[model samples]
Target: MTRDITIVGAGWAGLAAAVKATQLGLKVHLFDAANAPGGRAKSVAHQGQLFDNGQHALIGAYSETLGLIQTMDLQPQALFERQAMKWQYPRGECYALPQDAYPLKALRSLLFSKRFSVREKSTLLKPLFFSVSQALWGKTDDTVAHLFQGVSPKIMRDIISPLCLSALNTPVSVASANIFMRVLKDAFANPPQSCEFLFPRLPLSDIFPLPCLNWLRERGARIQLNHRIDDLQDLDPHVPAILAVPPWQASLLTHDKYPQWSMLAKHIKHRAIASIYVKGLRAESDSKQAPSSSYPGSLMCLNDHDESEDCVHPQFGLQRDVNASTRNSHPEGAEHWALIVSAADPNARQTIIENALKAACEQLKLSDVQLELCTVEKRATFSCDAHLQRPPCWIDSGLMAAGDYVQGPYPGTLEGAVRSGFQAVTQLVDASFVSSHAGNTSRVL
Candidate 1:
């Protein structure tokens, strides 16, 4: 098929590129090896219920992602259950405020909350102060551990370690300061409400993937599912193309042509995420209590620290059954625990899940919790470590790269993926304009 542009990999990035190209009046053809779209953000069907492969939260600061969803005509408020930004621990140290509150409001909450002592709070805020200051005058590129050695248990348990683990998907000792600062800067740049957690009301696929694919197909963009492109010659070479797959797949596809780019992408280390779903079954005697209000919040920061290296509890805990209190998904009057462990060891999934289920039940005060299912995306995100060099989006004149792993300030997030996809389409158009102008100049000469 003759298309103005072809998008490889129909995950968020590829779907995003196809959407933008269609908006720009380009003939777009999109393909993916998977049966469905969404890549790492896809949903899984188990026992007739849809659960996300992993917990993919949409922060208020995700302007590009939010805008893209709006363009698809999906109501943000309808699709997502919005809650104020809150940093909470299992033992209940909370830095929180209403939606769109200034970033300073979080600090205010911290100062007012009795969970951490003055010295302990100071310890937590000190590194943040340095990161903000570094964002201004100087360049600070180091690991989290180096930036704050002798990291006290109080401060670590309070917020820093868990936040870094969730944000970077890398251990604080090895995570990159550059990427960390970029996340902070992006957060501070957006509207105060941008930091609110936009937890999707529906399954992950219903959120963006299916809606987007429907939109594209409703238009004229060709959508090919379970189709793989083996070579560059297999695609429409006359048109520009965007390789929007994950770094591993991107590396494999480009190894024959762009060797250096391929190598850089191939060498990018990845972190894994485990989605451990447990059913919170209250005994029939406790059925009188409100099942919907059983959990304190939709999500909370978990203290996954155990002296034993074998016991790595989940870093985050969310209540999947209570997606929207108004909707009340748990008609059976049972709670479903959605626990997430970022930077998980693929081999030790069973250990992590076992520890996390027990710990989370105690922390959240669940009556009876039984393991439902546990799924892990081994290559969930890139290991955003110090001195990491990501590949560029613009690969060549006719080919471009589009994914979260590309050169960007943000970490591997949906926002990063969407931004890269939009940028890839822009690059394609810009390159064509430049080439046409060059030909015209030569003709005149």
Candidate 2:
């Protein structure tokens, strides 16, 4: 039989699967309920200015994602501004990894960072080395907080906590240590440049999904936008289908035919990510001035004490300076910035945005600021806890699953999503090939 694949959802995972399937000589049909392609990572235009759903950051470790972008002929250099990894805190402490070279730069930075005392630096480095070495053997499947039992409280609050929330979208106290270690290993254990940061210059949609769609369309793949699949049974049984929607949506789509999978999907918990886009801020005249309370780093972590019952201390992104050129090209006049809050409370979204804006104004020395937009993704990512049980890629021979929430080494990230998509399509192709060969042999006999 001729190989064909039907993908439900036009998000990163679905797009990845479709692209891979098409490359493998399989006819592909991709569907999405949205008018556009990108799901959570898409862009929206407000008053002639573009803003993403959230501030999505990327690193060199996103190999699959980079490869997919390359496959689509989308230049990563054009889409993103690559820089050295810098973890700056609002309190004026910074731990920056060198952009020039890997392990050497990392070691040098750790040893020479002015932010930590000798003892504090040693305390931080020892655990990281231990964790990396332990990862080689086998990591403990415990919470991150539990894993770093003897680490200093200062390191936990300043470094580990922020990194955990940003990476896993889960608090260190509850996030899976094994997964966290894997992320760290991938990030730091590789070549020196692997630690470099890639900030999207364009909107998330423009960077991947839209370009991917165009590429797929050019390759004769049928893509249907604003198309919702209400019933999985409606799809052709001869052609394998990949469900790349969120867990809840997947549960709804597969509840009848795949009851067990539906149950597993339903059991998966999720976390929220909130981004507050503020306008009417003035750009800093002097870029070289020392970091101040009213002028924090362009990207800085908030202290725990700054958090409230309804709001977590967000990682602020001052796009005012960075987007100055873009703003000049566009009709929008005001300076814009984004504050990303992970695991945000939906009920207190307004309060969270308000608090974040207030904090930004006070810290960044902004005299006048107006809220442009506030986007909250309530089910942004699965709760990456130690005990979380994600659904597998191969749901059945005819039906497969692909999404960030599916079983993977890393947490629910863009890399995880893309990797899952490729994995699902590969599994489908392999199964089909095997089945075809077996049937041909039986017929000959």
Candidate 3:
């Protein structure tokens, strides 16, 4: 009889595991409390328009996520619009990487960037050299602030700090330096395209989650939605199970079975992400106001530390034409703008949205913006602080766990979640194969 594998949680990690396990010819059973999948990365429809729980950015370096997308038979070109790395701030400062070659384009972009002073540009080399060397040897396991001890304050404010907040969802003062360095290594050390940004043309759910769910269902996998598994022991012990829920949920489910892992999961703090959607902004009719032909999309990084206090409102901003896609069925003449606030406060969500919209309008030279929708994910991602003790995938011989919070080189990201899923599934498959082989060998003896 084929070995049956039960998976708890229908998020990216769990879905990825289910797909891989199914491919391996295992009977797969997946469960989640939510009616639909995607977990924190999911999308919702409000007033006939679709929006993600939080605005997420993807880079070419996200190999695992990209691979999973391909494996699901989704064309990357159709799902995302790829562009070279471009960081446009509200203060008329832009830093765009060239599309030519690896180190050459990277160096050229840094040197030509108007955001950095000549002295600061020259100083940037030291950190780059150090990071490259450390990538080969090893990075210091400390706060990201300490990692760039002698770097210019300008570089830190403009580059490192934003990158840290966006990637790790933790402030640079406390984020893990090791993970930050690894991210940098992956971005610059690889091919130039690896540094390119991938903006989803569709809602994030359409990009991965819903498609993955359909793929699994069509393959004869049993999925139980809105079915919360309160106890792991309730399930049949003969079938191995993978718990791919959030860190907090995982803690609750594993407390009785694996107290140590539960403690670790409970200890893991979480960071919040708030996306404030605004509408009624004027589209750029003037050629001067429009982005270059190379960058047709509206993507901007908010100048969160300008002389004006209001400028430091949103961490990042994205503007999408509502009529661009027929999938969301957005009303005509309506535009959607999302301001991503990292480490957001739940109580002050309305105030945050208002401030963010004001800042965004001021920067984009638009007036009369209207607040359309505001969404906040309080436990969007686990805090990736220095020395953060994340729970491992293998909780016990018969049970495993998978999520972005699972101990990995990456922080809380789609890639991290998918990679963790693959890792957990591999562990389960390997153990099962080993056991079966051992049993056969013993019988032969």
By lDDT, the best candidate is 3
lDDT winner between candidates 2 and 3: 3
- Per-residue lDDT for 1-445 in model 2, tens only? 5466789998899999988887776778999999999887788776677777777888888989999999987889877777667766645657887656436676687678787678776766656776767768875588888888777777677777777888898888788988887887788767554677777877788899998998999989998899899898778877779999989999998898789989999999988888887765445662234233232114566654433222454655545333621344632444456778877786778677777788667654454777778888888899899978889988876789999999999798999999999998777766662122222221110
The lDDT of model 1 is: 0.75
| lDDT (Cα, tens digit) per residue for candidate 1, span 324-433 | 42243554756777788888886788787787778656665566677777887888889888888899997776789999999987788898899999888877776562
Worst 10 residues of 3 by lDDT: 436-445
Every model's TM-score: 0.89, 0.90, 0.91
Error of 2 at 161 (Å): 0.6
Instruction: Choose 2 or 3, whichever is better by TM-score.
Output: 3
Q: Sorted by lDDT, highest first, which candidate order results?
A: 3, 2, 1
RMSD of 2: 3.8
Instruction: State the local distance difference test value for candidate 3.
Output: 0.78
Give me candidate 2's TM-score against the actual structure: 0.90
Please give the lDDT score at residue 7 for candidate 1: 92
Q: Please identify which of the two predictions, 1 or 2, would achieve the higher lDDT against the true structure.
A: 2
The model with the greatest TM-score is 3
The residue ranges of model 1 lying beyond 4 angstroms of the native Cα positions read 1-3, 98-103, 124-129, 282-297, 304-311, 322-331, 433-445
